[model samples]
Target: MAVYTHVSAEALEALLARYDVGELVSAKGIAEGVENSNYLVDTTRARFILTLYEKRVDAGDLPFFLALLDHLAERGNPVPRAIPDRAGVQVQTVEGRPACLIEFLPGVSLSHPTPRQAASAGRALGAMHAALRDFTPTRPNGLGVDAWRPLLNRCSGDLDQIAPDLFATISAALDDVERDWPRSLPTGTIHADLFPDNVLVRGDSVSGLIDFYFACTDIRAYDLAVTHSAWAFDATGAPVDAGVGANILGGYASAFGLSSEERAALPILARGACIRFLLTRAWDWLNTPADALVTRKDPVAYLRRLEWYRANPGCFA
Candidate 1:
């Protein structure tokens, strides 16, 4: 989504030569996300996404991500698949980084989604979980609850710089979340980072779900919690739209209903979701280079969400 590495015309042409995608007309850098270097590549025949995996992404995990996309696409989930070259290779080396030419799915990412869009996104998430039920490849959630404290610890020294008492507040929230973290729940492959930008929508229906870099094996409800935390709130972390949250839950339930246990654990899981993003955003905010072609998201945005979830635990009820 961000362009850390620049692709030259010659290099891009050489890369395109390996595939039958025709002559490259244009390849513009996409600067929306912080994870990988992405370019909107256009050739004579079609359009595609050229993603250069960054250091944060493990090259070893490329197969799992690509295969998951293929699986989801086969099962009717709106996901982009990696395009293989003439040698049947999906992963290629670009400027010493792993890269892939991905199918370009049509639709625009919404910044402030409507309730109907939220509902459709929720339904797509449910349907994704259903499709992944039989997927046997398992990748652990690297950013799960267990990683929250350590991540926050890395950002502890600089916490007050972002906000007064931010460290203590996050520490206490982490303590509570860890103490009450769900022991058992339905687990599966989940799109752990289904933020508004990750979802592509045409009308009220989900056209595609992009960015599987964070997909992993985790508690199913936790995925819903992540989506809820993402779609239910505005950019400032205010839950000003109640219908958005309700419609998300309703649409998800219609597609893949949650168990009673999952329902009960939602509030806590939501808190954990908040903390997870809070710590990661804080870490990124503190660490990302100023000159990097990416935006440093506000860490306190998730802090507001955490406070809201704490005061309104029954929001999920």
Candidate 2:
């Protein structure tokens, strides 16, 4: 049967042979993401994550993204190491799509992360920031302001139709955020999309983080903002048991220690973070294919977050 993504099982197995890993025992589809087709492959030795890069991910950025992960793993981060083939190539073509195998990290995502767990995520994210501080990789922020402008323009014409006042409110919010978007604030590689599903939790602990397709060089506070948007809320858009913004910040602060300027930027950056996902989900909601097994994540969820941020702008402080 044809999987929902780039290629099929038979083609993936052929590529696996190029690596040192033994025969592939089994391959199964993963339905978590809407961006790419992902699979869990069980090899003779260990499990691996196979992704067929799709439209949302540019084929060119693979080297920098993969190399950055390798760099982080080398610094003792729990990031998955990308498997290279016998020819020492980090990526290859599989099923007519650029494919790569990553060591499967074992962990359950915590729907209800404890205060300690929130703190752990904070530190882990902070540690990721520290490890990538001096990374020489240069790539434009994929989810940056310029990228969002087009979507905003698309939504503006129908603002009154889709969600009425809320749409107008978000448009205005984006304008406000742009007026003071950080021009310079300790730039580094950031996990621009750190949603809970992208994070792996093992026994109430985050064992690994997956999905670096959205990773890019940007303001460090923006990364923290993405985590805040992900880890601070429940699936239904309600606030979960985790410590929310305050606790997450505490954990992050204890780890890499945010500067006063960084701390000051958190609220606005958090607003920007809320707006970023809001626009993307809105765009995806309109664009996702009907036959796809992956359910489109709600853009309204981020709208709720934006509402929350608007009401309590001082909460970040």
Candidate 2: stretches off by over 4 Å: 1-3, 156-162
- Clashes in model 1: which pairs? none
Q: Which candidate wins on lDDT?
A: 1
Which runs in model 1 stand beyond 4 Å of their true positions? none
State the lDDT at 134 in candidate 1.
92
Each candidate's lDDT (Cα)? 0.92, 0.79
TM-score, each model?
0.99, 0.93
- lDDT tens readout by residue for model 2, 275-302: 8888877777776687875767777788
Residue 97 alpha-carbon offset, candidate 1, angstroms: 0.5
- Model 2 deviation from native, Cα RMSD in Å: 2.3
